[model samples]
Target: MSIAKRPNPLFRNLNAKIAALPMIATTLVVFLGCSIWTVIYSFSKSRALPVNEFVGFAQYERLFRTSRWLISLENIVIYGVLSLLISFVIGFILAALIDQKIRFEDTFRTIYLYPFALSFIVTGIVWQWILNPSLGIQETVRSWGFENFTFDLIANRGTVLYALLIAGIWQGTGFVMVLMLAGIRGVDREIWNAARIDGIPVWKTYLFVIVPMMRGVMVTTLVIVAAGIVKLYDLVVAMTQGGPGIASEVPAKYVYDFMFARANVGQALAASTVMLTTVLIILIPWVYLEYGKKKAQR
Candidate 1:
């Protein structure tokens, strides 16, 4: 008879654990710790400098009551929904078109993705010029036989967010296209063969089969695009500057202005907390459902 020994769990994968220490420490200290601190300070009446005095929900109430903040919230909803819809629609369309193995595939891909290389600020400035009435699309069209052509969308308050969307879609659609292309290409070749054998229409196969299989990629792309929408500040700054009277204001800008410009740390933190809550609300339920489905499949 021989004695058997059990392995110690703590010592298992010791090298990997050591390698991950820095990242774990950083996440705990920077993200978790700072989040707790912000939440704690948010309940206090902190101004330019933080104070210990507790003030309950005054900050939140004040934040909600402000007209500018309300307007910013409305802008975010409109921009967020439209941006998500358009990006996915145009991106998937472009990806599906290019996936046909057509001639000049590389050229078309490069043309589509080229705009993604430009920074948002640069893209905003370029679009600002293109949308300018005096020198851009409007002017060019007017210079032709018709002098009545007007293509200005950036100047009007009602249509200004749409102008921002036009620039955003131009800059971001390429990225979404690349992601969708990768996901579509990653679908198992056998699935396509099976669909073909079953005589399933191409559109139905894509709509019912491929889209379901690409949920992982879609989730990743959704998170990235959603983050961009939530932090929509630089583009608005470069193009509109919340102009036409705060028409393009976003939550991030509201937090910044409160923290820096107004020197109301508590109010800013309250705003920041609400922003975090908003992101969680948008993501948590979908993620939970995905997890449930995966567990059930397993």
Candidate 2:
């Protein structure tokens, strides 16, 4: 017996159409709707109760004039840059070390990557405890006949940012290590063999050849780190609560305080809008360049 096979064009098209409908609806309803709502809210005279009365740019004016907002913006830039640079450096070093055909490689890799699995809340608290003046390293060292011991960045206004940077680097370096290691492993082994044959020092080969070859992965790592910086909230909250005064206040925490604690939704929304705009300003060009590269490849 011979069986007849039939191609159903309509069914395939219908399936494709159905598959896309949910995504389209979700984008419109969830993302676009929320964006529009937020924009609308930013213009209102809303306080604890969101009033429908439109107030034009009053909220934005207030937001721009706020010293806290300005400081938060500055802090974000400082934190983002420092965190990205430090994390990248540490991660690269750890990855390179681990890639050297070491024993217990998996164990070491897992140990390094373990921080990425932890919530910032937990990590931040642990770091905070470790950095605390009375209970942590400073006190311990002081007790050990080092009366002049001083690691009080957490309590100092000028150096608290560095303390946060230390915590951020500790938390984020692991992920960077994993990404960089993967990039390193994906590199052609023949290149290493060739370098070995040429008597090129491993360090020189890494610096001159391997590092340059990992540009895509490096960029990926940078973008991820940048996103983390932009959305930096949990760690700041858990560790400092933007404390020792508003010295360490970040934009996200500023927004949160205005939104809920201070009952100023309009200002909060304005701050949030500013953050969104800033992120776009920074990311859009990079994203476009990446997109263009992919398109050219295609």
Candidate 3:
């Protein structure tokens, strides 16, 4: 008797899925696994090597008590808030201006977006040079009979953070522009026509109608900017090296110096854990709100 033939399940085409599996596995193994391991290490008395000895909350205690760590945390909040606000404002303005049917639209767009393509390493050096009092704009302007001009924020203890803000806004506003421009482009043409018919000023239309409608984009932009804030290390390192005596220190740099430079793995891990927790605290609420909004829409 002939056996009944069945289709071969193993022969089904899963080439795309198979191809993606390795990348997915690598990301989980490297990124997620390392994160878990780091969190665990924070609880232990790990030094030059990751030790298994448990020392519950001691590292955290030390981290909190340290003045430099506290300063770094404060600086992070200031930088994060100011950078986000400034970048958003500048990006919105640029997007609005570019949307005005200006000449050389592509050229202006490219010029604005080019900074986002650069690594912070390059931008940081350029900014440092530009902000340097003796060698850069201040000196050059002073040479040209503008001796009273004072752009020495970079050298001032109280104002160095604002220098960072300037650099950060320059680097990040481009990305904000791209995001906001996309949102602006996606806006219904009919809305603009209706606004014109009602004799509403362009600025009023954007403030009252366009911006309110782009709340989703705004939130997404904020999240993107927040991620940059949480991981702010490279720019500080390249620009100031946390110097003029910890004047420009940030949390990531604090973690790095402790981890590799000082060989204080436990403290480093504690600092990292704090950073991770702070990001989660900020992100979770935003995510939940977005999810609820989407659900309500459905």
Scored by TM-score, the top model is: 3
lDDT of 2: 0.89
**Native-to-model Cα distance after best TM-score fit, residue 167 in candidate 3, in Å:** 1.3
TM-score of each candidate?
Answer: 0.89, 0.90, 0.91
Q: Model 1 off-target regions past 4 Å?
A: 1-19
In model 2, what are the clashing residue pairs, if there are any?
A: none
lDDT of 1 by residue, 89-196 (tens): 999989988988899999999999999998889998999999997899999998896888877888888889999999999989999999999999999999999999
lDDT of 3 by residue, 217-295 (tens): 9999989789879999999998888877888899999999998899999999999999989988889989899899899
lDDT of 1 at 103: 97
| Per-residue alpha-carbon lDDT of candidate 2 for residues 246-291, written as tens digits (9 for 90 to 100) | 8999999998998889988888998888888877777897899899
Number of colliding residue pairs in each model = 0, 0, 0
Residue 268 CA displacement from its true place in model 2, Å: 0.7
Residue 39, model 1: Cα distance from true site in angstroms: 1.8
Choose 2 or 3, whichever is better by lDDT. Answer: 3
